[model samples]
Target: MSTENGTIGSQGEVNGDVMLTHFRKKDDDDANGEVETEETQVYIENYKDKLLIYGINDSPPIHVTIICALQQGLLSLSGQLIVSLLVAEAVCASKNDAFKARLLSSTLFMSGITTFCMNIFGIRLPLFQGAASEYVIPLLLMADTDQTFCTSEPSKEGGQSPVPATTTMSPNFTNSSLGNYTNNDEITMDRIIYNVQMIQGSLVLAGFVHALLGFTGLIGVMLRFVGPLTIVPTLTLIFIFIVGPVIKFVEVNWGIAFSTIAVAVILFLYLAKYNMPVPVWTPSLGFRIIRYPLHQVFAILISIVLNWLLCGVLTYAGLLTDDKKNIGYNARTDARIQIVRDNPWLTFPYPGQFGPFGFSGAAFISCMIATLISVLDSIGDYYACARVCRVPAPPKHAVNRGIMIEGLCSMLSGAVGCGHATSTYGGNIGAIGVTKVASRHVFIATGVIYILFGIFGKFSALFISIPYPVLGGAIVVMFGIFFGVVISNLEVTNMSSPRNIAIFGLSIFIGLAVPTWAKKHKSPVQTGHAMFDKIMSMLVGNPNLVGTIIACFLDNTVPGTAEERGIAAWQVSEEDERADVDRTEFNEGYEVYDPLIPRSIMYSKLMKYIPFLPYKRGNVEKELGNVKTS
Candidate 1:
């Protein structure tokens, strides 16, 4: 055991010295002031402190970091593959199989590059960047619109076809329209290219808007208005929105879905507390024993493998039929097996591969809202990652840089024609919490792995073919926990206060209410202008965006004390004059610009006021000193 500052840490000495129980924060205790019985000491002493490993840039053993990175990278890739599949299913249903595979590859490629850039230059945390779920709604909207547009055209009857038709014949001299019958390959390519171009346009526009916000540091100003009330409903509504899609997929094969949920719950929750003793062979220390939480580390991966095995077994026994004609059986089978065969073994993502970019004002407007949603989601993730990593909450500049990188990479996503934007992956934050390994180097390695794996089209297709039921089952657990994490932030607020209660209840109600209403009445927000109407409709339809905007407005304007609204604890600012010094000293996750570089520019007398740079020592000290005296 050891003590650092005021915090206590202990290694697990579980077998003999179990009396040295796991330490819990006072806040974790019940009214009786007793710790939970499930937690106990294991092997390492001061495990939390020792597990700190390398603080951001402090180099650890190459092998160790590599292992950690590979694990995290693979998990991140798996999650993105699922997301890519979802996006493709929604937007590319009428396009060629190869086109969908290309979209998946492009998303993977862009995600890897974006993650690497952000880790190196942005927030520099261990957060994994991938396809944002918030953008899925907009993509689906575009797909639906495209479908309707095609159907409305008199020339194209039966607008929905998975694959284009092929026919070969000599042009009949008697028929003038015979010349217009193009080959199936050209028709398929044209449809795929057109869709990609439109999505690319929206992504580019949204990225530019987000980058501008981050660059001007305008997003930081908005953060002050966001309190726990704003976060809780917004986050919960996000999960609620996500659950609709999961239910749609899972409902296809309830038996497979239920089985998946059962296995996942057993592995992730039931076996979470059980640790297995394993022998560790260290070169210098010889063979020693350690108790490891193998279940926590491999819960998702194991659950998936178990479900896959069950699927295979059931199919072989004829209990679960494998029929392309049946949606239920298709949900459980590797129905996308053709994607692997169609795409090359190895292919790199090239910008404009789908053809020239095309712009749509309505699509751009929808994407703008999605970008705003991503911004809000990323902010919550920033705080979550910091908390799990045992670091102080991010200051304004760090948050700004993170968003800036997100925007910049979003542009790259468009350039690569991924048809979706990139943002921090909530799944990876969960992974860090489970493994308790918060090394930025590991994420850096993960980024490299993503880039490498993305080049292999077959690998992307392999994961893409994972049963939809399995994916839905994982989403149930993941989104459920996501909702819980957001709600848990309420602990800082005075939940019993009627004023707080009203705000929370109203925010959630409006969030759910608006989306439900918008869906039932499509043109609810119609202004004569089509683009403006589309934008408002999209915003109203998204529960997270609506709830967040309403909650932020109420929390900032409503008559309530800072304590009642949870702002005081949620945004814990120090009155110390060394605020600038504290940021420099505490940021172990990623190196912000060197202290010397900012100091060199400080002679201009206006550098500290800038949004991208770190706080100015002189100005911060002056303001903080005045506050201290007051």
Candidate 2:
């Protein structure tokens, strides 16, 4: 592997056994499109740190963007646009036409950038771009289908439309924003065409960076500073940031929220009691007694179904509001999609679309921070792939090459009005681990799908229409799951220290609660913390203004003295340590850290807290050892 140190090995691995272990599927004769199994993901690292990365192993990292996507959709707007563009470029830049690594790498990179941007800039760019994992196989199917169908289809003028159909090249599709399953709408074809140009623009940047890195050979230098432990925490923090906003949402929309949660619970149980369909055929569970795919798709899907029925019931009971304005903005948006299908392309950004573009300065200024986050994302994604492949693709230079590809792609995506930089995501890694299919060729197929989706924007519209509450429910589960995962990952060198435990709890509490209070009061900053303008006579100190300024520079920007950040990071670390210990104790074991499984160790916490949950009347001093005895 190429690194700051040097080339350590070929960085290429080809073991029939490891492949068989992680990548195989029973139904697929052609294993290239097969799904990755949890077993394979479980085997990624073979050392102590492995335990740390998996965070109790059995669950998903729900915190990061999944929580953010549903609540604010901040990242969904720009972040999604950025990653999609970069991914398309990365896939296009792959040599030997091997695009899978480029796409998968983007997933982790997206997560990484999300972490880095928040820490480095006084910016928290929304990081909700999930990996385009689910779409890969479908694109592959389309690519490999008969030329008569996949390449060119019959026209819509009755039978074949009588218009001669011609085959066209598919746009590279791994562009993520192109294929999302939005909130509450059906997929349409118009979106597919518009995306092709956007996807093209995003990749244009990737090609430049790839060209620069490939020819200059600077890929080796970037790998030295990054590692798993640091990255894991940042990603973990993402969930923290996301969950805070989501919890507030549940509190605000209790009626819809409760119904949504109930639907997810029922679906999880149903899937557990019976066999269900999964790509390449699969069935498994570790916690929530719920199958993963079912939770991912049907948790929200079934919730919507039940909610619609409930909508009717509420109407019958005279408790439902008849005001269309209060129902939600989704219905009109959905109808708009159908109306705009034929003329959707007319909305694309134009150079002079608004005035002469002379002083469009604020537009770029406000978005400048967002653009940089995309770079961090690109860098993170490259490292994730470099680490996993374990061997340097070019004898220790692949990371640089890979990043360059994404960087240039970012510029292109930005020019096209996407503004968000392209990066990788972790969600896609789950897909890779489950499917075991690592072929770049299939990724290219996926890229083509994105292009089509971009062209047919209605597809995105359908997902966008899904109600916020249904999304809120999914975010709740994911946030809880991510909390479990992060807590599982929260290990420290000195866990016994009291100071550490206090710090851990306080940091988590503050981070979550501060955001909570702000969201509720709609007052992100207090008047005392606001900036004051000192006129010629006197000064006006607005706490909210000062707080806003401080909030902007506080955690991210290099504000104040070194003493400030060190103290803060350490104090937070202490709190994190306790949370980690508690998380570990709760999960029970290495088997996916399934807390759902009955285990004795988990009871120790409640018993420790209340000193009463356990049936056995064990002495408190003995149960908690140092806590009570000391």
Candidate 3:
């Protein structure tokens, strides 16, 4: 291990036992990539009060920061685009172009602001925040409950149809202005507006619940029971559940899908080991040549660009068809050009941009379930992200604050009529691992990029046509790596033990199987009460939640010691070489109070005893006693 003075030994960081390995290296050299400790010391010292990373404060050049930010920002945009489109189709019934445009603008705006909050004050990591999939099922259930809101007929001008059970609605429904709709069409718009209002109200309420969970410190206590076994399957299912969507896109154009996938693999895997020398000027050091992994850094974006170029060439050659049904149709270029021509150059999204808000019991209950799932999934993301950044697991307080920030974002989404919620994107989190660029400043730049994209409506619209197969191919690579990351957490666990194997095996099998079956069957889970049944069906229907719950429950209930379950080794301690030995250090780098804010509740003894306050200071035994009771 490297000494605290920042000197390295010849042995280097290594371990033999796979079942007892820490996820990240303890040495500073490996932890901070090529950047030295003194280079990042100023930023870390400035934010000494919070849990900041070398990546966040490591002052990369302005151009490097912008490039990294844009790269990570694109990954986040892909998820937001998918969710915004789904909301336009599922909730607006492919009829209200105004609502669709408003939803897209609002989410883009909300995501930018929320992500800024998360990086600065919440998780204090390089995690990219984006639209979450947890709300999709609940929103779909809400739409199904009121068919009038989503009912549609084939358009006279275009081949517009109702959102199919097998496919998302085509964008052709959002080609005109709301004023174009006839008197009868206005009535349909009214119903759709009402439905949108109900969803907004429910999400607002759910956000409050999320805040309560964080404030009461209940989330901290819950974290005690979450082990690597539970996390492995939970994180794995996130990617596994995307199989349906990936298959749908791949089936559309196998050639494009294969090409995109091939490029991503070649860049990410094949070229990953090679680094190119870049010249840089430093005041003290004079000049230096840094071997940067340029190819791997731009792998995902490069793969997409290569595919896009091929598609454009085919389009020019007249080999690409205009028919939507044809496999050779260049949807990427066509959609981009069309949206740019249709939308305004600039548009600003504000509160209540769509219509008035309303509430429904069924929608509210379903949203609560969605909130829980989002929280659970985010916990796994926190761990995985920390691992990639070469940091220890976040402490109770940081996790609580992270969720609270997400709740705030959710409320903002509801207010803005986004019809969906925001959460940390696992795909982007995994990218931190793939690209090995975990700079906090880069992500801050990403937030700025998102905001700029949102403001320039035409600018955002241009990317709306990103080829489906290219995106699908990228999804496959990201999710595949995410699954590998989840399994890596199990390195500390005794995989050879039949008991551990059974726990992981059963949790994963059921998590994937239940959701697949539920989606195919489309049968409502009955619980006698209508509202209760709707909620149950929504919760049970989601694959990620089902798998996580099963794994968490079985892992805790089953008989085994902490070591046998890998809990002991998976966590970090003060003795670890990478850890700071300050008494205030409470699991990882997260402190109990913000040094910048003296009047913060963290300073109060009464608050410390409240359990979820994350207040770890003097009179520790008293605080523990109070925690057990409160």
Candidate 4:
């Protein structure tokens, strides 16, 4: 092993099974060339002062594992449900309670499947995968521009369209004759189904492209040009552009919405350090009190539950309005109660469950753009997760495998008609930092729990029945966190430089301006070809896409050194030829990310030649020698 002092063992002495531990004497050597070994405690210098309850590779007791898993599962589930609800609203499915419930169930199921696969075979990090808000931006844009769904103008005050009355007609009607149409509900259902099918097809195509990028090692090449400057504006605009949707939900009942936001803000910020004493039982210690950060760990969930109860009580007391046309009517707890009764007890989402898939060039482009952003965000998430887990940064091969798996999961999501892609949950990573539990076993168990909950249709129905105001409150806090996190990327760049400031300012300004102008002036891009015009208009109108393209163009072309542009720190070397001692020492933390397979097969000669494998041919020989010697 090697440390700051020096290497402590010969090459043959390195043992793969040995846990990483190092010690140093407090006092220096005396004048006689002998060490002055003072009486001192031998502490693990790698994690010294961190006091982590569980490390990346450590497996806790079964009970502890289940409890931690539940916490993570709930946090991820909340985010996924919110994204599903937003997609439902965008696609004009808000009035169809059964369809909304099905959408929620599908999203949850896919998230569980993806999260499960990610932990075992993907990056092997303690990160949760869920429905991403990034894709929602494009979905919203697509819905707004669709001729079938844009027959009526949305309300100018709240940006919400009136919810159509429920109908009894089946959504799977195949009659294409206009004479078969009985009411507007039939047309609305057909449009929603068609749009969902289009999304599924585009997601499948986009996912294939995404997987190719990873499997071919193109993602690493693309990262060479990406820096904080490009990421900051792209991600910032993602959250900022979603304000219209959040406002639509929040305006349902400002009183409840603001209350929810206030509770979340207070719990997450003010009461974060405060701990609650909880009783615990163990085989050795019968009963014990443990200090848990309950508020910090469950800030979002608690706020939703508290406000939901409040809305329920107010509804029972006849305080909330029941009038369909009145404001704040959606805040009532019974607003979507019918969904709970309509949903089945169990739902197993399968491919082509919705209908025959449909393809669209415009939708494909939008999904591809969103997929690129998801890739960039996930790369950053990997580094952040590694730092929080106190492990070495993930190697390039591990990252490629992670991206490949993510793309496959998105394909699965599309097949099931979830209308969104899956990405790493940043909130769960933040929970790891607060709870100090980064065990992969815990996350794996959490994935199983997610699968169980996803199959229980009633559970998903209950979350879908959450009041719009409460959801709005949660969205405000959730997206607010998302915006702040991405904006913090600015810390890595030379913010003091006028060049950077000018680039950021111009990109954001044009990003917002172009989209607003396009929205006001329909058919702004008047190319002779209708399809080409629509695609070009969609690309230019999206704030995130515009800002990303502008920022990337400026950052790459502008004259600046790598260090000044933060590229030096942002980019990790593809290969590091460290000395044998240093390589063994670093592997202690990195081995946690290795694939769940026999080392004999993983480091075999044939496997070493594969670009996506974690080990190289040269390292295989050295690793085999160490194994044989040990």
Rank by TM-score, descending? Answer: 4, 3, 1, 2
- At residue 390, give the lDDT of candidate 1: 56
lDDT of 3 by residue, 15-108 (tens): 2201112222234456556544332211001111122223434556678678778777766666787788777666664655555665777788
Candidate 1 residue-wise lDDT, 1-630, digit = tens: 433322344444322212134454344447765644433333453232233334555454577678667656655554576567667655443344444556677888888898898888788777789888878776676555443433311233435233221221112211122122223434433344445566787888899888878889987787767777887776677777666667766776777777866875676567666665657776645687766555555565666678877777766678765767777775654566777777678877766555456676767876887898788888878877766665666666677888988998998888777878899887677656555567778888778877876798777667666677766676565555555556666877899988788888998899889888988875768679865666667667778777888888888887888778776654533233234445433534223322225343643457557675565455545655675798
lDDT of 4 by residue, 468-494 (tens): 888888767765665555566576678
lDDT of 2 by residue, 1-630 (tens): 234422222212322212112332233345684643222322212211111112212222243223312222221322243334343432222121112222322332332333333212211111123332212212222222212221122335434222111112123222232333221222122222222233334334433554364335443332233222223333443544445445544553467767877765665444433323323223542322211233432344456556645644554565644455664332222322442343233122321111111111222221332233233334444333322222121122223334443454444443332323445444332222212222222232333334433444444444434444544554564344334433432332133544334444444444345444533432333445322111100101111112222332333333333233222221212123223233323322112111232445543545333211112234545645744465
Point out where model 2 deviates above 4 Å. Answer: 1-255, 258-320, 327-368, 371-402, 425-450, 478-630
Task: Point out the worst 10-residue segment of candidate 1 by lDDT.
Answer: 168-177
Q: Considering lDDT, which of the candidate structures 1 and 3 is the better prediction for this target? A: 3
Clashing pairs in 3: 55-440, 56-440, 217-612
Where's the lowest-lDDT run of ten residues in candidate 2? 532-541
Q: In every candidate, how many clashes are there?
A: 8, 81, 3, 0
For model 3, the stretches where C-alpha displacement exceeds 4 angstroms are 1-54, 145-187, 277-290, 515-535, 569-630
RMSD of each: 10.4, 21.1, 10.1, 8.6
How well does candidate 1 match the true structure in TM-score terms? 0.77
